[model samples]
Target: MKAIREARGISLRRLAKDIGRDPGFLSRVEDDKQGAGPGTLHLYASYLDVPLAAITHKEIPRDQERPGSPHGDDADPPPDGDQGSC
Candidate 1:
């Protein structure tokens, strides 16, 4: 998590503000002392310019060249054929 934040040049305070959370709380989450709920993780991913799956499912192997891979050029689309923009 810290790596992801640093990769995007985001500070803890700024990320907390963007996600409507407290810096200390965010810190705990990053330190793995506390867990962020799915909703909070989603917000963090959005604010940090990361994919939700990256944080939520860390064990999953990513194939960057695949269309839906987080590291790929294509942004993931919603299921159910929805065309929602990220």
Candidate 2:
């Protein structure tokens, strides 16, 4: 999500302002530290000009993974250099 947003030249501040959310909260969501509800997901999809399925599909598969599994999608954090500063 963060990658797509950055690629589209959308800033965290601007996205939050447009979606009526706090930048910090949205940042957490982007970092996968928080889970976005359906409403929030819809807002993001609408603002980003993406289909809701694009976002929901990624989330659904992750949620179905067994807890404490040794292997799972995104079980590892991205490399430090890959993250852009907000």
Candidate 3:
């Protein structure tokens, strides 16, 4: 997540503001000291123009979050023991 943000030349402050979150909160999320909820992840995906899987590393079931969105089953699941490292 941090890498993608940096590679896109987006500052932490800018991302936080765009996502409607505090910079400190986003900083903690980037550092792995905190977890972003599904709604927050959605915000990130929407703001970054990426799929939820890109922000979560796992596919959200078709019937779960995105409904008719393109990010279901087709996403590659994370490796063994992986946990939201996107």
Candidate 4:
């Protein structure tokens, strides 16, 4: 999560504001001390301009799928299909 945030160059405070959450709360989420709700996850994905799947999907082992490739099922699609545009 933090990786994605950094990749997007979004600060915790700015991300929190974009998500309508508190910076401290977002900080906790980033540090893995807190779990974000589905809504919050959606917001994070939207604010980062990345597909929610990129954030929520679990990486499967190569052995779990074809050789040399990780595969996993897509998470339930982002709640509203359209997370609010910035």
Error of 2 at 46 (Å): 0.3
Worst 10 residues of 2 by lDDT: 60-69
Misplaced by over 4 Å in model 2 are 57-86
Clashes of each: 0, 0, 0, 0
Off by over 4 Å in 4: 57-86
Error of 4 at 81 (Å): 53
Model 1 residue 77 lDDT score: 56
Ranking by TM-score: 2, 3, 1, 4
TM-score of each: 0.62, 0.63, 0.62, 0.60
Look at candidate 1 and give me any clashing residue pairs.
none
Task: Please give the lDDT score at residue 8 for candidate 2.
Answer: 68
lDDT of 3 at 43: 90
Provide the lDDT at 81 for model 3: 75
Q: Is candidate 3 or candidate 4 better by TM-score?
A: 3
Return the lDDT, model 4, position 19.
74
The models' CA-based lDDT, in order, is 0.73, 0.76, 0.72, 0.69
Stretches of candidate 1 off by over 4 Å are 57-86
Q: How close is candidate 1 to the true structure, as a TM-score?
A: 0.62
Candidate 4 least-lDDT 10 residues: 61-70
